[model samples]
Target chain A: MTRTLLGVVIAAFVVLRVWIWRRRRATGHERVRARWGPFAGDVGLVAGREMRERFRGKVFRVGTLLILAVVAAAIVIPTLNSGKAQPQQVGVVGALSAPLRAIVVASATSAGATVHFVPEPDRAAADRDLRSGRLDLAIVDGRELIVDKPPGPTGTSATAQFVRAVSNDLGVAEAVQAAHLSAAQASALAAARALPLQSLQAATTKGAVHTTSLIGLVLVFVMLSQYNTWILIGVMEEKSSRVIEVLLAAVRPIRLLTGKVVGIGLVAFAQATLIVAFSVALAQGVGSDLLHGTAPVLLASTFAWLVLGYAFYCWVYAAAGSLVERQDQVQSLAFPLSLPIVFGYIMALTAAGSGSASELFKVLAYLPPTAPFAMPVLVGFGTVTWWEFLASAAISIVCTVGMARLATGIYRRAILRTGRRVHLREVFSRAAG
Target chain B: MASLLELVGLRRRFGAITALDDLSFSVPGGQVVGFLGPNGAGKTTTMRAVFGLTDLNAGKVSWNGAAVGPAERRRFGYMPEERGLYPGMLVGEQLEYLGRLHRMSGTDAQIASKMWLERLGVGDRARSKVEALSHGNQQRVQLAAALVHGPELLVLDEPLAGLDPAGIDTIGGVLVEQARSGCCVLFSSHQLDQVEDLCESVTIIDHGRLVVSGRVDDLATTGPRRLVVRVEGDRDASWAGGIAGLMISEVNGGEARLVLDGDVDSDLVLRVAMGAGRVTKFVFERRRLSEVFREALG
Candidate 1:
């Protein structure tokens, strides 16, 4: 199943990449026109500069490597531990019956476990072996099962449930033999019919989905904060250094801001793609059940959210950056701006950990700031329909458009006002006045 | 022909402070105009307004008889008062990027950037980071960036500030060459001598208003002409004070400078000095731009 999903993802990526390449070639003349066009050329220039600087910077290289290392560790550790899992060991004493032994072995096999049964001289010897931890459970005189400790009443453990099934099968076989029925009757009595069961609600793959949700939330949180800060610091540096004056001379404020965000957005996207590809490939190679069934879907959702989250927050950060002329001011502003992100992250993380979506989380999924963190988790939990996902994404995009417009205004007004920090209220008032 | 650039009734206010008050000026093609003002006199504000960098409360900046817009502004180059360049970027690459922003093709931008750097005497330092360059070299790179796109109009603010004499001459020569190539050049400076040497015309502002503006020779000629007389003898030329309507502004040793009234003749002042002593020199001179600026401002 994982292999098929992996194949599909790889094929899709290749096809999209080729399609872009072919389109670029087919529209070569249009591309040239775009390069020389008034707005596009200016935007392209700024974006090109940003992309070049970021790709060549030490921070980007080191940060990506660090994240990849973390992802690899997260996948490899669980797989290695699962590979080293030990099977259950049982001990039997005093003429263990053939049917009983057969039932015990069959139950263990059905439970996805192996059992190694050893013969003991007496019940005392079986008890000693079990207590010494050489055996997981002991059967004395082929009648009673004993263990060092009692299994929980819920019987959720595979070993406990397997023992119960073995005991029930033995009881049925003993009753059939005691009835002294004919071969056909004995056989019919021993064969218990399976019970028919029905459930009104469909069962959810809770464990895998919950894990995917948590991973998605973290990725969105980290990518948004990191990249948004990059935009903030990047703009602040440009402004304080007064390089923005030079750039604004050549291009419009809106185009410059757009190019900056687009450039850094592409960098963020590239790093995210690399990390996701690494994770999926690593998970598949290690046969890790961590991202088993929903790996491809979860990854794609997380990436989409990353883009949305960045699009929503980058403008705010960029505008805030223009308001301040110093790095210290950025530090103070970053916390307040990150409040919604932090709030949404914690809530989404809590829901993901508990394997359930809260009502508040469902509401937050529609808000642009929190939706990047919440909607993906809701999707993971199967609580949100595809239409709901689309609605949330559409809402985020619309909000982002509004934010970009507002941010552009603030940035244009405040970027050149250098001296003390420019207040947001002042920017608005200045615009109005 | 229409003025290459014209600011008609430009007005801007920052809060209660009026940065520019009905400031109007024009620069013709192929001419270098000096934008001179005292500190806080709105010279920078006027230049920024020309490039549409500042919001004007009223008025318009017209380029070649049309309202200037981004497209026209893109064809224009500006070096702001507070000079800035990305310190982390390579000098050549930064200029090329800026050229591209001005709508130059990639290859064209690259070639132009390289050529400008070479012309500015920083061609060998193209690969060096901006921060790695000396202050003078960085200023050169800044100029190169402004000119890399071959803009039709160049507006520079304090382009000669903080430069050594040699650096000043180099940049001054570059601006002259730009003007000679038919690019309209307007720059502001506190250094009147440099302005006198480079600018064909000047616009002087004070208190956010134009105090004086005209061709350099025209402005000087419009001011009072002085008759300077230097006698061969060591005797003082106090006799110049006796001449009617010829106010002797200065008389020291054998030399005297007299400001003639409208009805007075400069030759009369010289003849009077020649009679007072054996006159070795006699000249009629227009007031220096610096003197004219001080007189206008005062």
Candidate 2:
């Protein structure tokens, strides 16, 4: 009887708490309305609607999952491959002293690799082993090195650097033994350092930075295209469905458009943040050096450019969306609209792949359409300064403002003129008249 | 005195075509006004202009004696002829969202949405997606969205275009109720019969110009009255055509309808019919608003 009474009391307490919570929520809504006035309130309402719709949409959920899978693959694949990397195997012909083997091992260790040296009777046996995949490299009489492929001048591969270092050390040891130098002299000779390289021009090539830039470029491309298309298709759907008419009745055209862009933009940014956070956390967990050197700056720049790129394209796509009344028309319109984006992406990818920006790419970096791609690549290459990035971003922003105004005008005029797809010329003519 | 809603000298041009030419009209508070016109007669354009959707070359739309702007428009509910709601959105949630857009608090919007859904007879379908509802049900949801905010003024373009008889009656009742509660209602429709039943007043336009506008009774009464007479004896009434001021508009089965000249009296037609034979039925009646519209357009 006492337990039953306690249960009843608890249930009543729970009901009371729920009632209080609902009341608080109701008052909170009222407070928002009172604080923001009708214009902001309407904008917020429209934005809230967009956000809610997107959150509940299957397309958004599926697209986010797909992109995240791609991102995970991009980050995890290389780390897994590197974790399973094989040690470099060297086959030595003729006599190889213990000192020489020690030097090779030390060089390999310094270059962040493992080496296994196998002795052979002669050059023929060493060459046979190297050709038959029993060895990665063959050293003949401790003087000549043979490999399947020659290293580039940049010495980008750790194995190539290790081989060079080992060969140099062997040469010094041979000369010292030939001179019959005292132990102290030999020690001093071994302690000598190689000359530092001073170049007349700045070095533009960095393996890690180049890879990060390429990845960043691809990320920016995928995200800008995806989110901008969302804005486009979303606007088209709303316009075709005549929801814009209902929305326009409550808020001004500009406010409605602004709310839509902002709402979708926030969704895109949130997804990007999730992907980045996941990539960072995963990279840390796997102890990958893929994101080494200026990684934070690269990430920040990539995000900034993603925003600028999206801002520049979203308005254009939305305005185009307003001109059409059918889903099929969206496809016809999207191709033309996406031309610049695709072009910019390809150009940036080329520059990133070649590890240097072309003069034309440098020029494109200042233009809003291509800057979102080119500028970030330049930043990663260490070819652009902070002010230069700022200048390019400012230019893009100014252009975006102009585009936004023009797009708003187009949207307001064309969104209501349904039935047939409206011509751009017609919209302009109507505006002028 | 300033009217509840007023449009004065509204002139709008699109390229070489003028959609509205010096169009002017007003709706008094607590009255339902019908906007009638032939196709491409600028009814939709004028309605769009009221919501400031169309740019005017020269004109003004004022509400409550103040220039209509976004603020005033926010309080004004509008249903465009192309009835649209997000297909993926649930009916009740969509209504509440629209209510919020019109500045209703969330809780108020929720209650109003529920009340309208129930009132519109779609209470159980509130959680259903709009596209999942039948066309008639979708129409009801559309109306609910418009009324969810309890708008001060309602403008609906072609509100009953594709509705069945029952749907039409339901919408008419709701609109009448709204007007009775002091919400000025303006609706456009091609259905003249529905308009006659619902509207207290009407404005008809053709070629972007106002053809006729006034109280339904007044507009019907302004035109010449017709006289109908039937004789008990089997006789033709075609002779009534020969009357100096009476033009026989129709003659069939001993009954004749005479269209009297402006100065002619219906008593003369009745006397003429009485001389021909024992008069069985004589009645004087004003034209219907539909006939008035046709004649005005002609």
Candidate 3:
């Protein structure tokens, strides 16, 4: 009886707590409305609606998942391949000396490979194994190295590197042995180091640095393309659906448009943050060298440029979106809008791969349309000064403001005038007059 | 003082077309006014101008003798000519969102949304997406969206255009109830009979100019009275020509419909009709609202 009474009390308490919690949750928007005031309240309502719709939308969920899957594949595939190493087959013909065998094993290790010596009954057997692809390399007695193909001057294949290492080390060891050097003299020759390379200018864009910049460029291009197009379609949908008339009656056109872009921009930022976080965590967890030695500044610059790029292009797409009357028109309009982005992306990619920023690339860095791609490459290359970077950002920001104002004006005028496509030239002339 | 929504000399031009030309009207609190006009008569333009959706080339919109701005507009609920709601959004949620946009508190908005939906006969369809509802139900939701915040001034353009009779009655009742609750209601519609039944007063515009503005009864009664008489013998138009203020507007067989201008004596007209022929049927009636609309536009 006492336990039953206790259970009843607990159940009642639980219900009461739930009711209170729900009551608070119900009033949360009221709190936000009070805090945000009237102007922000209107904008916030619009933005909140947009955010909820987009987040619940199937396209966003599926698209985000697809992107993450692709990113995971790109990171994991190479790591999976690198984790397993195949042993190099070395055919031993005739008599093998311990010293020569030790030399061959050391050369294999230096070439980042493992060697397994396979005893050959005769040179003919060794030649057969080589022809059958069973043996990567063959040693004839202890005097010569044999192979199906000779390593080229700049060949970087695993077998080519192994053969070259073996030949070079074997030649040096044989020469040292023939000189009959004492232990100390042989040790001194083994300990000799190559001269350190020095240059008047720093070589910053090399190896992984270049790879990082290329990845950053791809990210910026992708995010700019994806999110800006979202703003475009979103605006177009509101206009085409005739919802803009009802919305414009409640709030100013500028606020509604601002809310839309801001909402979509938040979604973009969230998706981007998730991808970036996932990539970093996955890369680190797998001990992959993909993001190894990536500079924090490079990551920060990439994200900064991403924001700048979005800010500059979102307004343009929004303006274009208001002008178009149909979904089919979106494609024709979007294709021309994407040309500058594609151009900058291609050029930045080329510069990143070559590890050199050309004069044209430098010029493009100053231009807002291409700067998002080119500026990051320059930053990764350590060629652009801080002031120059800030200057480019400033230019982009100023241009964005002007573009936003113009786009807002166009949206206000064209949003309500339906039935036909609005011409940009007409909007511009109207504004001018 | 009763709050009044006043549109004074509103003029707007769309390129070469003048959509609203010196259009002026006033809707006082606690009254439902009908905005009647033909196509391109600037009715929609005038309503759009009130909400600041269209740029006015001249004049201003004032509320209670004060200039109306965004703050004032927020208090005004508007249903555009083209009915629109986010088709994917739930009807209830859309209303709540609109309520919040109009500056209603969250809790207030929720309660009001539920109340309006129930009142609109779509209470059960609150969870349903707008696209899933029938056209009549969607129209109810559109009206609910406009009224969710309990706006002080309600402006609806063609709120009755697409509704069935039952829908028309329900919506018409709700609008009347809103006005009785001291909310100013101004709606545009082409249904003259419904306007006559529902509206307290009407403003009729033609070619962007105000053609008639007065109470429905006054507008209907202040016009020429129609006197119809059917006699045994043929009644020619010559009998009505003898009366100074009476003219035969229509003649069919033995019947003649005369228009009595000003204060023409009905007894003298009855006597004249008796003299022409043995009176069979005789009745004097006020002009219908449709006749007033036609004559006003003309």
Candidate 4:
């Protein structure tokens, strides 16, 4: 399953590249027309500078390596610990009936375990073997089950489950043998089936899907926080360094701001793609069940939300960055801006982990700010339809356009106002007046 | 015809304070004009308005005879009062980037960037990060960024504020050459003497209002003439006091500097000086630019 996912990701990248190339070719005439147009080559130049700076920065390189290392460990460690379960050793004292032995073996199979039996000379020997941990469980004279520790009430552990299964199956077989008047009756009792179950509502997502959703939510949260902060700091750096004044002289504030956000967004997208691709490939290579049986739609939803979430939050961060001229000011502003993101991430996490999307969670899926995290989980749970996802996306895109305009306005008004922090109220009031 | 840049009725307000009030001036092509003012005299604001960096309350910036727009502004280069450049970027790359932003093609930008860096005497440091250069070197790079695109109107704010004498001479020479090449160069500086040396004309503003502007020689000569006399071993200015409409502005050892009205006879003042003692020196001269600047502001 992971291998297929890896292949799909690689193919998607190739398809995206080809589509971009074709789109460029299609837009060639338009680009030519725009070459002599106003603000031509502005955004590309800005984005290129940003990409170069980020790629050159040591922090980006080191941070990506660290995250990859952690991701690899998360994938590999589980597989190593849970590789192949050790066989359960069971001791039997006195004469063991053939039917009883068969029942014990069958019980172990039902518990997803294997058993090896050892004959004990007496009860004391069986007790000694159980005490010494040589035997996981023992049967005393075909009557009682003995173990080093008492089994859990629900038999949650592997050993406890195996012991419980063995005891119950053996007891049932003995009772059947005693009650049976004919062979057909005993066989019929042994083959009894459970009644069919039904539910009125739709079934929730399976455990694998739930796990995938949780991972997607985490990726969204981490990526949003990381990239939004980059935009914030990048703006602050330009402002504090006073390089913005030079840039604004050559380019319009709107064009400059647009270029900056687009540049940083590109870097963020590229970094995210690399991380996702690395994770899928690592999981596939390591034979880990992480992301196993993950639905393609769920992966797409996660990536889509990532883009949408970035689109929604980047402008806010960029605008906030323009208001301040100091690193300390950036810190003070960043926390308040991140409040909504943190809230949405936590709420989405709860819904994904619990495998249940509440009404509020569903409502959050429609809001642009929270939709990036919420809508994808709804997709994972199969609670949100395709149209619903599109509606939420459309809403987010609309909100993002509005946000970009507002942010551009604020950035334009405040970026050149150096020395002191510019207030949002000041910008808005001036615009209104 | 060489292009002319004009700022007409430019007005701007920062809350209650007016930064530029009906400020109007013209920078003719093939000339270097000094934008002179004290601190907070709207020089920077006016320059920013030229590039549309500052929102004007009212103004029209025109080139030649048409109102300047993005296309015209693209042909203009500016060095802000507060020097700004990406500290982490290579000097040559930074210049190239600015050149490209100003509409130069990639190859043209590269060539111009190299030429400007070499001309600014920072050619060896082109590959170095801007932050690694000395302050003067960085300032040169900043100037190079503005000039790299061969702008028709080069506006610099305090371009010579912190330069050493050699740096000043280099930049001053560049400005003169740019003007000779038919570019209109407008720059603001607090160095009055340097302004006098470099600018062909000047526009002086105070409290966001234009005080005086004209050809440097015209403005200086239009001010009241001074009559300077040196006596043989006499330190008193009583010789010049006998002449009507003559006021002694200064009296040093054996020398008296007098301000004369238009009707005052400079020949008679010299005669009076000769009668008082053996005259060593006599001359009539217009006020210096510094004197003109101070008297205009006062």
Q: How high is the CA lDDT of each candidate model?
A: 0.82, 0.82, 0.83, 0.84
Candidate 2 per-residue lDDT over residues A1-433, each given as its tens digit: 3244345546654864775475447532223232122335655766666776776678878987887787677777776755645678998887767777787887777667788778888888877887787887788777687876665556746667766767667778889989999999998987888899998966666666776677688788888888788888888998889988888888888888888888888778877766666666666667766568876578779989999998998899889988997878999998998899999999988888877788999999999999999998888887889999999999999999999999998998899888889998888884532
Tell me the fnat of candidate 3: 0.46
What TM-score would you give candidate 2 relative to the actual structure? 0.82
Better of 1 and 2 by DockQ: 2
TM-scores for the candidates: 0.81, 0.82, 0.85, 0.87
lDDT of 4 at A310: 94
* Residue A102 accuracy (lDDT) in model 1: 79
Q: How high is the DockQ of candidate 2?
A: 0.41
Q: What TM-score does structure 4 among the candidates reach?
A: 0.87
Q: For candidate 1, what is the lDDT?
A: 0.82
Candidate 3 docking class: acceptable
Best by DockQ: 4
What is the number of backbone collisions in each predicted candidate, taken in the order shown? 0, 0, 0, 0
- How many residue pairs in model 2 have overlapping backbones? 0
Candidate 4 pairs with clashing backbones: none
**Candidate 1, residues B1-298: lDDT per residue as tens digits?**
5248988998888888888899888899888999998999999888888777788999899999999988998898889888788889878778877888888877787788878888888888877899999989988888888899999999999999899998898999999998888999999999998999999999999989999989998887885777778877745567776878877667777677767788887777767776777888788888788887888899
| Interface quality of candidate 1 as DockQ | 0.36
In Å, residue A62's CA in model 3 sits off its true spot by 1.8
